[model samples]
Target: MDPCTYKRYHKHDQDSRQYLDHYFSDKSQMVFGEDALIFPIKSLTNAFAAGHIKGDILLDISHGSLVHHLYSACEFFKHMIVLKIKDRCILELKRWTDKRTGAFHWGHAAKHHADIEGKSHQLEDKEVKVRSAMQHVVKCDLEKENMTKPIVLPPADCIISTLLLEAISKDQDDYIRYLRKFSRLLKPGGHFMLLGCLGETYYTVGRDKFHAFSYSDDFVRKALEGEGFIIDHCKLQKRTAVSDLTDYKAVIFIAAHNKK
Candidate 1:
């Protein structure tokens, strides 16, 4: 199914809301893995705090689940930019790729794709340039589209984006594009922070699931370097036996800006 439909299905109506409450409260395999968006931001906040991160400027990508956590974490920031892009762009959908090797792969996960189960899909792309400019690094027009070249951004003291890029990239190039899309965010003398699923795959809504792409730590590092984020610190965020779900951890990246 497309993202619009998936978003509709995920709407917190009274009935679906009831299911979420029960699902989150469950002490079994089902609930623990099901709830990812909520935990990553909380975990990321604590991780940044663990490093004693406090600054006067901040930027966040993917505004959905991370909104509350970011607002709470960056109280010192005089400016904060929250970004929301396609979780899975219906217009820019691409096939899955290998997490480590960046190779194309497909599977017959028929049990999951009840809707759009056998439909032809296209590769999706996000404007990494436009996205990079959105985070208060500089003043760029959000009203325009189809930019010819990337614009520059002001160096921020700290930047945070969560669970983005991984979901939008259908192939390695797309992943690189997603990373390059954010290249301009870090200015000289700036810092960076990102939290994403290390090997996250599959998205299920009320019993409907779909195949998803996840990136490895190596892939993430390469993409960051490709985008000008030189890695200064990296951490394995959390490994919880909180439930029986496969152990998926958030890889946190803290890089320093080297650009003049």
Candidate 2:
């Protein structure tokens, strides 16, 4: 298929041009953490819920501030795990988990917190005193980085991540190394979906730079085969990320899982 231009919210529109304005336009404005857009994550999660793609544990480190991704877990998976690696992500999470429910959800970044009742991360509505105190809270030293370790995947029913692989090692060897890293994150026969910009130029948030890495499925397949993952499917979706009216090419990806 030849590359073509497209809109940014193509999934909302089967035609890839008509962007679904919102499920509920007025109600769309979330009161608490309106700064974060949870709609797309919600859309993807809803698709997972409607299907049989639930996993025992799910992790999305995309750094997207979409909070609805968490709610979808309530319907899709028997077990759900989430991690917020950034402060903005935490803010988005806290907004939806306000103490009004008399429950605190953030703890050790897992679903286990939901199972056993315990003290965990709490939501705040602008407690300057508390925020100030956290400044003085010292964090533990970083773990010793290891390289050249034999890469292996951990067993999980499924794994899904977006916009993360781009942040890992960039070259072919590093890309293969990342494939090996995720291999350790998935179960022997697990499934996963990686949705991203196959031809993205660049995007920066705060001080971070996310560059696009476009490769054919054949290229991806060759690399993953070496890492124990087989290419089960490949699709080029008409993503709603057209930078200009003339750009038809959107995001492309190779979705697969463990082979052996």
Candidate 3:
């Protein structure tokens, strides 16, 4: 799609709450339970728990308002910076952080984190911890030379992006460009934890179809390597649900570092 077409599609109505519910709610797990959602969540938990990834500051450049992948990593970071491409997504995330009415339920994700840590009874406490760790929410522009404009943030010790690059990028070149942009936010030797859909071509939000770049594991590795990153660990979970909502073949979890 051309720039105009992409912008038109993006500007179209997208019910963030409904979209979040469809993918993140407890019921949605029946569709993306193990491979798409659960595996990535558990992998992050284990990575932090095992000391594979730990840092004082974390930068999350997520596509949407979802935070299911963040529960387990909160305790490892003193401050967390969350960035989004759209104001609507930022507002949706703020609603949850500010404890406003009509916020999507995140208890299930918190509970899942608690269970992983063997503290299942303190679900509320876990939620509070995750919310408190999130210190800033800023807007990001991938097309810009600097992803975060106006507000310059401290270089992060770790960066996390979930299903963001492919969903917004028009193709491989765009994806590579965005990956390089993301790397600029990190300090030397800083970690990058990326969660993405493998081989996905499209996804729907509120009846509007959005383009997704179909990518393989090798492509991701090459992109990271080209950007001067050393791959540390990578895992792939094959798709289980055969649905029309998306055409993703697998879910990929990768942990890499800026080459020192």
Candidate 4:
């Protein structure tokens, strides 16, 4: 299939519910439960616990309506501002934040988070903390000069973007450009944590196959360094589950700080 024919994430309509069901359903097996969900949660939890990433404001530019990753982050940050490219994603997340009747249940993911932290009894409190910390969910357009445009956001002390650049970028240059934009959102010396897939391409959401930019660990390091970020820690986990929903060789977590 020609690369151009592949659906561009920002340009096309995405089914937010289907995305949540396929990858984040409470019953999802190891493939997503382990690599996609647990891996990032553990990484974030450790990072926050070790005093590696923390601050007053955290900017989140993640894919879909998933909130599993934020369970750990809310403990470390006072406020969180989520930027989404799709209105559907914003609405889906709002449903959960507002405690609407049909919001997607993330109890399983929260339980795992609690289990890892040895606070299983505090599951309900964990969910409440995340919702309270997540103050704003604003729509953004990455294609523009300023992603948030008229609604200028304050420089965040930390930024956590998961599985978003790979899904939206068409090529390496585009990836770098987006990285540059992300860098601009951070204050000097602020931390940036990124979780994404390494290698492989094309992830299916519902019936549509969307493009995923393929790159390696070295490529990511160079990209971050080029954008004036100092790499602090990098962890790579080999893929353990077999499925056709998506093809990714490994999951990567990188923690870096913007250089002054």
| RMSD to truth, every model | 15.6, 12.3, 2.4, 1.3
Candidate 2 lDDT, 113-226, residue by residue in tens: 222213123222222222221221111111112221232212456665555454343456766766576566566766666644454444333222334345554566677777
Return the lDDT, model 1, position 75.
Answer: 37
User: For candidate 1, lDDT tens digit of each residue in 159-191?
Assistant: 676555554555578768655556455556566
Output the lDDT of residue 184, model 4: 92
lDDT of 3 by residue, 87-111 (tens): 8888999999999998878887777
In TM-score terms, candidate 2 sits at 0.52
How accurate locally is residue 11 in candidate 2, as Cα lDDT from 0 to 100?
16
| Clash totals in order | 5, 15, 0, 0
Q: In candidate 3, which residue pairs clash? A: none
What overall lDDT goes with each candidate model?
Answer: 0.44, 0.40, 0.82, 0.90
Ranking of candidates on TM-score, top first: 4, 3, 1, 2
Candidate 2 regions with alpha-carbon error over 4 angstroms:
1-52, 67-74, 99-155, 206-210, 244-249
* All candidates: TM-score: 0.53, 0.52, 0.93, 0.97
Model 4 clash tally? 0
Q: Which of the numbered candidates is closest to the native, going by highest TM-score?
A: 4
- 1-260, model 4: which lDDT tens digit per residue? 66567787888998998888888787635257788888988888888888768889999999999799899999889999999999999999999999999999989889989999999999999999999998699999987778888999999999999999999887899999999988899999999999999996888888888899999999999999999999988999999768899889999999999997
